[model samples]
Target: MARDYAARCPVYPVRNAWLVAVAVLLAAQEIGAPKVQVAEELEAYPTESVELSCQFNDGGGLTKLTQVSWIWEPSDGHRDNIAVYHPVYGQSFPNVAFKDRVVFLHNSLENPSIRISNLRMSDAGRYTCEYATYPTGNEQGTTTLIMLSKPKNSANGVTVQAGTKSVVVARCEAADAKPAATIEWLAPVGGNHSTSTTSGPDGTVTVRSEYRLVPTPADNGREVICRVNQKTQKQPWVYPIKLSVEYLPSVSIEGYDHNWYVGRSDATLVCLANANPEPTTITWTAASGPLPETVVVEGNKLTVRKVDDAVNTTFICEVKNRLGSSRHQITTVVIEALEDPSSAGVVAGAVIGSLLALLLVVALIAVLLTRSRRQQRRGYPSSGDSIATGSGGSNGGDYGNKARLLFSNSGNNSSKNGTGTNNNGPIYTYREGCDATGTLTEKANDYHHHHLHHASTGNAPTAHDILLSSEMDEAERRKFDLDDSMEEEEERYDRFGGVAGGGNILPPAYHVHRGHAGEEMDVYLDDDMESQRDGSVISRTAIYV
Candidate 1:
């Protein structure tokens, strides 16, 4: 059956050779072999010393121990003798490759283990402990020495790839590790992945991991990390992959479709988009208003050129690229007017300034008015009303403390006389505070006693007394004029007996006369013969003129 299969299957020859070699080694080690076991297998570094342990387990029957030998077999070549130990001849290393570098652990009884110094990469291979006895023949056990190597990374980390929804290409490799290196994807994204391993002639390994992903916009610019783990290294080796995905534009507006006042200086809108191959053209179009005559559509900025009552309209901004195009729309509100911010400040400042000035003026006027009132109140008693008595005699002294004065019609200042003298004026109305006329007034009851005394004596009048009355107030002067008018109607003065008119003459006495209408007229007795008398005619007896 084997011969028939070898003829049919061309790969059978190669597989049979590998099987035969392994079978022969197994057969040799099983039959008549001493119980020899290698306890430890160790790693080696150049210029370092290491010991490979071989222990005798259930030692097979042997009358005399012959020899113990250590053999070195490289991974790519045949076996070699590292050293041999004998009870009498001692230990000796015959292999030129491990000449001075190897020694037996025991001196007598043929040591089964050997120590090696100044280890080199060439010394990395299988090591065997061989026992030689008279009857048991040769028996051996083996251990392998592994050479250590640091891992290396491959593939560019910044390679950009255009990926689709179904399949995205990403690759990472870790090379030059002793055994096969374990490769894994740290961040497993999108979909599944596959891996492969290859080996070098020196037992160095390379592991390559490939990823097939279904990428989306969210995955654009993502980093895919590949990690390689090896037994010789303390930590896993890692590499990053930057992925870029190409897709349609994702569109938005930054500043668009907002209310803009009519008087605003600038009204602006913005359009934003993320796309592959970038955007080549940017444009703005108006729906209801006049579009800008010449607008440079270079960027995402959209300037609403004509913002007025006429521009209450909608606007559209378009961003275009090689892959696709995107558009955004915005509407404007037609506000009739907007307050100028700068001008508002100015108007407010002016209003405040004007109000301050008005308040200052009002305050100053109030201050001046208050001062005038105080001065008027201070000057009231002495200057507003005054009294001067020309007569310094009993009449003046009597009138000094009087509250009220009433002059009778029969007195020298009475209405019996047509010409009233001494400025005994009419009564005047009194008002509070000072008047604009600046008139002066005084009570005249102080002169009543003197007047009575003078009348009893029948004194006509003194020039000094009449002169003293001349210095009267406005109220006195007005009263005198009123009395004089009434007296003129009631009395006619006789030039023969009454006081004289003109030249400031004083009144002598009071007299009454009858007129044509049978009215009595008060007349002054003429002292200078200045009055017309009835004796010119024959009095009332004569009657006719």
Candidate 2:
């Protein structure tokens, strides 16, 4: 295989010539491309200093660094050479707008960064770092400089008269801001707001807002806030103000209690008014006639020295402001006595209490009467004779014994009927005796062996039954007299067939009395007899024959 290859070596030399040509083309492309480094964007506040950085890359030393320049390009597409730096010629500021404000930092073409002092809003523009190289020509990079200005905010309310049509009540503004500010309004009441913007020559904008409403008296002193939002501020600036709306004076009178009475003092009436401008004049008058001498007028108050008949009239209070005047009236009536509102309740309560007390008393009396009747029904025991015998005088015992013996003799003398019907009236003795005070005093321990029966037939009550009846009213019982008892006794004798002329019954007028005992006695019929002190009738003669 190591034989002579002279013909193949000639083809290899032709391929090597093409490879060498491609290498030279790539080497020239890399040498001609150079780079200038700068930030894409930058920010600074007004009147503050900022550095625009720029650096040139000569593509691995294939191209040479010549001179570097800083150019200002505004948004309007206008360019100016502001600063330039060269290794031999040093640094130069060509633009008069940046002559004293901009300077080259390093005085070398590799790093041509510039420091801009006393920055203004107008200085906000795109800055270009341009490099002039030998074979690569011009290489550039741009950086935008943003200048921020925080807005000064203010708000105020306008004074307006109350009207039907809508008017501006408040205004807010944010002035001298680089970026336009957005405005908004906050009001509790019903209203509308509008906004506008203005631009300044130095790239600052002014924002304004107005709040409008149909002004009314109620809208006065209402708080409204204006909020401004700008790019330069972290939080929105708020301004608060109050609206002022004026109207006519609304007047009224106060402090009348309707309890003004004669001889009463410390009464007063005050004139109250609502107006934007305070009321200037307050007047008091009387509709019936001139004001009373008891009334003392000072400012808006009318004080009464003393209430009297002359104060019983209509009173008027008038007030006037800058806008208009208003008045109020009250009718007063001086009464002879103070009208106490709680007096009616007190009277009603007293009446109720009295009625309750009366009911309690009635219940107590009923209980006492019931207990007394129960004792009587049980045959109440006593220490003396079973029959109720009274001792009106020293001979009272002898009189009672003789009367009982007479009654026994009469019962035995009565004859039997033809049918042997036992026709004899029952003799009844008093179960209780009364005193002069109309109260029963004597009580019987036992009902003596005296027969008692009803006068008429058919279940009618007897005299003894009527006397013991609890249903009888106390007042009616007090009206009972000895004459009535005698009449009842005579009826009973007749019913039982007692012959009055045959001496079977005692005479109705028969009486026993002890005048020396000082006992007052009577038997009543047609008001001829007077009442007895012991409520008993006695025969004046003690002879039973």
Shift in Å, residue 67, candidate 1: 9.9
Give lDDT tens digits, candidate 2, residues 61-151: 7878788888899879999999888788888888998879987777678888889999999899999998888885888999999988889
Task: Please provide, for model 1 over 320-436, each residue's C-alpha lDDT reduced to its tens digit, 9 standing for 90 to 100.
Answer: 887778887767676755677669989999999999999999999999878755543322111222222112121121222111121222324322222233323221111112221
Q: What is the lDDT of candidate 2?
A: 0.66
Q: Pick the candidate with the highest TM-score.
A: 2
Q: Tell me which residue pairs clash in candidate 2.
A: 426-451, 511-538, 511-539, 511-540, 512-538, 512-539, 512-540
Residue 227 displacement (Å), model 1? 4.2
lDDT of 1: 0.56
Whole-model Cα lDDT of every candidate shown, in order: 0.56, 0.66
RMSD of each: 22.5, 13.9
